[model samples]
Each structure stands twice: as structure tokens, then as C-alpha cells.
Target: MKTLYIDCFCGAAGDMLLGALIEAGADYEAISKALNSLGVDGYTLSCEKVNKHGTMATKFDVHVDDAHDHPHRHLRHIVEIIEAGDLPKEVKEASLETFRRIAECEAEVHGTTIERVHFHEVGAVDSIVDIVGVHLALHQLQPERIVSSALHVGSGTVKCAHGVMPVPAPATVLLLRGVPSYSGDVDGELVTPTGAALVAQVADEFGPMPHMRINTVGVGSGTKDLPDRPNVLRVMWGDAVGDFHTKESITVIEANIDDMNPELLPPLLEDLLESGARDAFITPILGKKGRPAHLITVLADDKKVSAVTDTLLRGSSTLGVRMRKEQRICLERDWKHVLTPWGDVRVKIGTYKGTTSTTSPEYEDCARVAREGGVTTREVYESAYAAAIKGEYKDA
Candidate 1:
């Protein structure tokens, strides 16, 4: 599997992330042309080689005309600006969701609604370019997995549009909630609000670099060099170095519900899956006072745990959910299409050490084909299995 690892030993910012992506193989000219159409004006994008301490890195820049005249934009305004241009659906949606994440954090910090909370630094043309550029670059790279090292959020006080605040400003702190991060020895604001949102929301898991055959290493320079460190963000792009099985840390959320109507459980499960949950199920249980209850168990990527937790709390009778980190081993899985007598059936094939270990025909596909062909699902399944056997499916 193709993977991208973010090394935040120094820190991360929107520009830094974009710079890393560009240096890692994202097309800069394409990103520039896309930004030119982003509807927000008065900004020209540029990238150049910069020396961060003794090492060289790419520095992404956005030169905004009349920087003082830029408006403090609200969430709606920023959305309009992003929506005004032609962009890939994935990039556009991801970019919008990122802004929403930031806006939500800002609203929480300032005690205001997301719609009413106006962005100060984040609203500027330059920051807008940085966010959009980062998304565009990711779209271009199309990595199957994005992992980040624990963020090194610098220490000490820093001044921002919100006045003097501690390192990791209020919005930054709120954004980094539940994310693995630590304050480094540097005394300054290393992770900006945009940086925190980008990394926290984008990375599926936070830890040291996973096992991978290293490819290109892109170093992105910060605004200024630090005396102790190189002050650069490194992006490692490579293929997963696995023994056909991979290990990952997942967040498991569980809650016991006895008060909510039983009919609501299915839809809640569906909602959880739609909101980034990997698996969501309910099991029957006898609760306090011997009341019949359903135990809701949710599994999700570390990045999606917060949304899954919210869904569990607000979408069900459970007042709160318990979360725990658990490591899981997964086989290398891929899909194969089998031509059944009734119709085509999709088969999920799991492999280990380059050997096919298991195959499961998609029940929904088999059932649909059976229904269309006026046959039993069992017959369809058998025929699908026979066809797959003849094809001798191989690992993807």
C-alpha cells in the first residue's frame, strides 16, 4: 500500500505541509493553476529552495497584495471562496471539511457559533492558499495511508490575532485534542491553528513512521531556523513494508444503552459507518436492574474517533462513550470480481505472505444477482465460488 508519513519533529503549519507535499512529488504548476481559480484574489503562490539550518528544504509562500486590506472572513465566506472554483470533488470536500474543523475549534475557543466566528489569521488570502494547496497536493499524491509522528508543538507564549496566548494557541490546543502531541524545547508557537487542523484531521494514526520501503524524503522549511533543530517538516513517501499483514492502532468506543428505542439502533450504526467508523455493531446484554439493553461497540481510525464518539453520544441514549486504544493485525485484503451464472459477484480476498488465505463473496452482490436471475442465493454463491476457483484469484 502506498503511504505518506509526516515527520513533525520540529512542527507543522499549512505552508509547511504544502511545501512538504510539493517537494514529495505533488505537481506545483497544477496546484498554482488551481489556486488561481480558487475565487480568492490578490495572492500569488511561490515555492523556492531554502536552507533550514544546514539542510535544504522547500518553502512554500503566498504573496498577498494589500495584506492589510484582507477581510476577516466567516465560515460561509470561506466556503464560498473555495466553492467558486473548479476542483476535484475529493479535494474540494476535504478542504471544506478542514475549514469547518478549524471554524468549529475557533468557535469553541471564543464562545461563539461556528457561523458567527470570524477567522483572523485563517481568513487571509495566504492562509487560504496554503490550506487549498495542501489539499490539492494530497489529491495529486493519492496516498492510500497518511500517518503522522506525534506533533512537536513548541513551548512558551506567542502573540496572534487573538492577542497574547500560550504556545499552542487556544484554537491550536482545541484542534490538537485527542491527538498525540508534545511541547518541544523550542519556545515559540510552532503549530499554528491551520497546522494543527491539517495534521490532526488528515493523519489516520499518530506514531513513529510505520514499516515502509523509503522513497522520496521531502523537507519543508519553516519561516525561521531554530538554534537547536533544523525546523523543517519531513514527509516520507513509500510503499508499506509488510509481511502481507499490517498492524494499526484503532480506537474502540463502547456504550450500553437501555433507554433508546430498539428501532434506532440500525440507523445509528449506519450513521457511525458513514462518519468514518470502521465497524459498528450492537450486542444484546442485560443491564442494571436486569433491564434489556444493547451494547454499542464502535471501531474507527484514530482520526475519526472524535466524530464517532460524538455520534455515539448524541445519536443514541448513551450519555457518554468509553474509548480505548487497541492494536489490530489485518491481512492484506483486496477485491476480485467473479462472473457468476446469474451475474457478477464481488469477492473479498485476504492474503498473507503472498498466499491467498481466505475469500468471501459479497453477500449483497450475490443476493442482488440471485434476485435478478430468479435463483436462490445459495446457487449463486456456489456458481460464483466455482468461477473464482477456475480463475485462481491472486493477491492484488
Candidate 2:
């Protein structure tokens, strides 16, 4: 599968993401054409090759005309602007999703609703172009999946429209609720609200750069001078290996809790998943005091080990947790559509040793079909499986 890995050692902003995409082979002319089609004039986009520290990178900038003075815009206004644009549906939706996420997080941080939230810096013409142009560029690359490194949020306070606030800013912190992040070796706001929103909305997974063959590298420079590191974001585009079999390392974190309320367990599991745990479960156990207790375990990547551990400790009534590294083998999997008698069902096909090893209809698909056809979900599953076995679908 086509994959893009974002190395955010210097954190990400919308323009930085755009620059990286262009440097990684996305067409600049195509992006400009799409932005023009938006009909939101008064901004000029440009990129130039620059050297940061010792690494060459692309620096992207959007110069907006001072005459165009739409400083603050509501969520509806931004949505209308995006919807009226003539860009591709994917570009429009992706851009809208990014803006919407920012609006939601801003509203939550400021004690308002999405409808009432006002986007200040995010609503500027330059930022609008940066956000929309990013989606346009990403559409051209067409990576099947995107992964990112933990964000370096930077330290120190930042002065913004909302007055002086801690580093990462309130909106940025809200957007990065579930994502893994850290304060890097810098004393400035490394991550802007726009940058945090872009990654929070677009990234499919967050962890270390996965195992893959190198294809191309793109470096985007940030407009800053740091004492300890170069201000740049690196993105790598590559193809994940074939053959369907893969092995990777993961961390298993476990804790025993007997005092936490049982009612809170469900939300704890959900929180763990949202916090990037591959899996989380609870097992009944007997504690040292002979009291019935629960053992909670979470499986996650090494990058997420610290964040997941913190979540377990805070969300549950546990003072400490145990963790260990383990390896897991998994088959490469893809979805296939099977035409059943009642409806079309999605079947998961797992490949191992370059051969198809397992086929199963997605339970959610089966259940939906069963509900519509007035039959048992098992019937839908059996029919879909039979269809797969009979090669009823072309892909099957």
C-alpha cells in the first residue's frame, strides 16, 4: 500500500505540510489551480528552496492582500466558503474536516459550541489557503495511509488573540487530546493550532515510522531559529512491503485495580482505544486482600507506551502499571466486496505467505444486510462466505 510518514521533529503547520507535499512530488500548478477555483482571491502562494541547519528544505508561504480583511469567521462561514468552492470533492471535504476539527476544539476550549466559535488566525486568508492547499496537494499524492511521529509541542508561553497562554496554546492542546505528543528541546510554541488541527484531522495513525522501503523524502522548513534543532518537518513517501506477512514490536501494559468503580470500566476501555492502544481488555482477578479485582491490559506501539501508561494510571484507580515489549505477527489484509443474495457485503481477506489464508464477512456489514432483509445476521454471513467461496464477486 502507498504510505506517507510524517516526521514532525519540529512540529507541523498547514503551510509546512503543503511544502513537504510539493517537495515530495505533488504538483504545485495543480494546487494553485485548485486554490484559484475556490474563488477566494487576494492571496498569492509561493515556495522556495532553503537550507535549514545543514538540510535543504522547501519553505511555503501564502501572501494575502491587506485589503482583504476577513479576520474572524464562524464555522458556518468557513463551511460556506469551502462548499462554494469548485475544487474536487475530496479536497473540499478534507479541507472542511480540518477546519471543522479546529472549530470544534476551539469551541470546547473557550466554552462555546461549534456554531459560535470564531476562528481568528485559522480564518486568515493565508491560513485558509494553507489548509485548503494542503488537501489539494495530498489528493495528488494519494497515499493510502498516513502515519506521524509524536508532536513536539515546544515549551514556554505564546501570545495569541486569546492573550498569553501556555505553549501548544489552548486550541492546540485541545486538538491533540488523544494523539501522542511531547515538549521538545525548545522554548517556543513549536506547534500552531493550524498545524495541530491538520495532523489531528488527517493522520490515520500516530506512532513511530513503520517498516517500509524508502521512496522519496520531503523537507519543509519552519520560519524560526531554534538553538538546539533545525525548524523543519520531514515527510517520507513509500510503499509498504508486500507478501502479506509482517511482524512488529508492541508494548503490553497491565494494571490491577480493585477500588475503581465498575461503572467506569467501559469508558476507560474506550479512552484507551482513543489514546492509541491497539487493544484493551479487562480480566477478573483476586487481589492481595482476597477482594475481587480487575486486571486491565493495553496493547500499543512503543511510541504510545508512555501516553497509554499515563491514561491507564489516571483513568483507573491504579498507582502503578507493568509493561513489557512483545512481538506480534500479522497477515496483510484487504477488503473485498461480495454480492450476496440480499445485498453486497464486505469480506476481509487475509494474506499469508503470499496466499489468501482467511476470508470473513465484516460483521457490521452482515448485520446491516440482515436488518434490511429480515434475516439473521448469521444467514447474511453464511451467504456472503458462500459467495466468496463460489467466486461470485469478480475480486473474490
State how far residue 51 of model 1 sits from its true place (Å): 1.1
TM-score of each: 0.69, 0.64
lDDT tens digits, residues 1-396, model 1?
678999998989999999999999999999999988886767677799988888999999988788546889899998898898788765776788789989999999889899998889987887888888898998898776799999999999998886899998889999999899999789998998899999987897788888877788888888966886788999999877676327777889999999999989999998898776889999999999899999999998765676678778889988888889898887766678988767788987777766777888889999999999999999999887877767644332
Residue 105 lDDT (model 2): 87
- List model 2 lDDT by residue over 1-396, tens digit each: 567999998888888888998999998888887787767777788889988888798999888888875658888888888888888765776687788789888888989899998888898888888899888888788776688999999999999888999998988999999989999668889898899988877776788888766799988889887766778999999866664216656789999999999999999998898676889999999999999999999998654565678788889989999999887787766678998878989988877766788998999999999999999999999999998877677573
Kindly provide the TM-score of model 1 when superposed on the true structure, using C-alpha atoms: 0.69
Task: Go through the candidates in order and give the C-alpha RMSD of each one to the true structure.
Answer: 5.7, 10.3
Total backbone collisions, model 2:
0
Lowest summed lDDT window (length 10), candidate 1: 387-396
What are the runs in model 1 whose C-alpha is more than 4 Å off?
243-245, 248-329, 333-351, 354-396
